[model samples]
Target: MKSKNSLIPLIFSLIFFHSAEAICKPRGFDYIQPSSNASTSTSQQQQSPSPSAPAPNQVPSSPPSTSTPISNANSNPPSSEPQPPSSSSSSPAKTFTPSPAPPPTSSSRPLAGINLFNQPTPKTEPTTVDPAVKKICDSTDYPTLCLASLTPFLIVGKTDPVSILELAIKASTQQAKLALEAATKLASAPNLPPRKASGLSDCQYMFNDALDNLESAMDAIPSKDYGTVNSMLSAVITDSETCEDGFTGQSPLAEFDDKLRMMGSNCLAISSLISPII
Candidate 1:
C-alpha cells in the first residue's frame, strides 16, 4: 500500500510537469507571433481535457504561471544554468514593431478663392429707333448724335416727320441754353485768361442767339415755314464755330459748344425735309 501510494504521486507529478512544459515552452520563432499562436492553438485543441489544463483565453498571455518560477531559476548564464529552454526561450519568441505608426497627415489652409463681393450687373437691350428718326438723322452733320437726341421724343399729333422737326428744334434749344449758362459761369471767374475770357464771353452771346434761333425754328414748324427755319438754324453753326475760333487751345465749354453745333446741324437738315410739306 505505501509503494502504490508513492508511485501514484510520482505519476501525477510527471503528468503535471509534461502538461506545464508543453504549454509554457516557446517555439523556435522568427520575430513573428501568428504562426506560433496557430501551432499552440492546434496543440491545445488536440490535448485531452485535464482538470489542470489552462483556460482558452489564457492561451495568448506572454508567460503562464508555470513559467515564472522556471524563468527565475534559468536567469543565470546558460553555461551555469543547464535549464530546459521552455523558461528562458519565451523572451525572444515573438516580436511585432506596430507597423511604423502610419505616416502623419499634412495640414491644409482654408481656401483663398472665395469671393464675398460677387455682384451681377443689370442688363440693357439695344434701343430700336424709328425709320423716320433714322432717315432724318441720316441727312444731318452728325447722324448718330441726331438719332440719339431726336429718337427718344414723341409727337402728340404726328408720329414721325413733324415730330422730327420739333425734336430737332427742342434738342438745339436745350444744348445751346446749357452752353450759354456754363459759359456765363466761366466768364465770371476771377483772374480768367484773356483769350479764355474772350472766348467764354463770345460763346455766351452765340449760345443766346442760338437759343433765339431755335425758338424761332420751333415757331416756324407749326406754320411749315421750312425756309425761314433752315436760314435761322444754319446761322447757329457759324455762331458755335466763331465762339470756338476765339480760344487758343480746347475751350472750357467744348462739351456744350460741340453738341450745340451738331444739334444746329440736325435742326437745319430736319427743317429742309419739311419744305415741300408747306
Candidate 2:
C-alpha cells in the first residue's frame, strides 16, 4: 500500500514537470514570431518600386512614337516610264520598203513556147497523130486489115480484153475493119474463153468476111460502085459473125493470124483513102 502511495506522488510530479516544460517551450518560441515579422518587412522593402521608377515616367516628355522623323526613307514611290510611238505622226508616213519579188526560176518556166503570163495557152497544140502513125495510115489499107484480123487471136489470150480491144479500135478504119475488129475481139475475149466448138471459128469467120468485103470494096472503087462496096462489106460482116458462136480453137489458126496481122497495116491505109472517096 505504501509503495502504491509513493508511486502516485511520483506520477503527479511527472505531470507537473511536463506542464512546466510546456510553459518554458512557449516562452523560448515567442521570440521566433518577431524575427519572422522582421524577415517579412525586409522582403516587402526589396519588392517595392524605388525612386527611379517615377523618374523614367517623368523624363519621357520629348516626342510621341508616331511623330518621330524617319531617316534614310524614300519620299515618293517609283513610277513606270511611257514608251515612244513607233511612227511619228507629224512626219510623212514611213514608206514600207518591200523587197522586190524574185524572177521566176528556170524550173518554173513553161514548156514549149507557152507563156504563163500571156496568151491563152495555144489550145494544147492539137494532139496530132505522130508522123510515123500518119505514114502507117497513108501507106496502105492493110493496117486496118491487120487490126481487124488479129483481134480474134488476141482475145483468146489471158491479157486484159479492154486494153486489147482499145488497141484494135485505135487501129481500125472503114466499116468492114471496124466490124471485123469488134467481132474478133468479142469472139476471142479472155473472159469469154474458148467455149466454142470450132476453136474461134466465129473470129475467123468475121476476119474472112472482112477480107471479102474489103476485096469487093477495092474492086468497086475502080468502077465508082460505092453501093456495091458498101453492100459487100455489110454482107461479109454478117457472114463472119454468124460463125462466132461456133468458134472453138483448132486448125493451125496461129498461122492465119500471123498472115492477117502482117497484111493489116497496108490494107487499112488503102481502104481508108478509098473510103473517103466513096
**Who wins the TM-score comparison?**
1
Model 2, poorest ten-residue lDDT window? 116-125
Q: Write the per-residue lDDT of candidate 2 for residues 148-228, one digit (tens) a residue.
A: 333443433323322332333333223334344444544555654446524455565667666665566556655766467
* Model 1 Cα RMSD, 1 decimal: 22.5
Superposed model 2: Cα runs more than 4 Å off: 1-126, 129-195, 247-278
- What Cα-based lDDT does every candidate model obtain? 0.70, 0.46
lDDT of 1 by residue, 1-278 (tens): 99999999899999998898778767873333347649866566447364356556555334434633345664864586475667645576577667675643423322222221221111331288666567667777677777666644655445476777787777667667667767777788899988788888888888888878878877877787777788888888888888888898876766666777777877777777767766
Top-lDDT structure, candidate number: 1
User: Once model 2 is optimally superposed onto the true structure by TM-score, how far is the C-alpha of residue 220 displaced, in angstroms?
Assistant: 0.7
TM-score of each: 0.52, 0.23
Model 2 lDDT at residue 139: 56
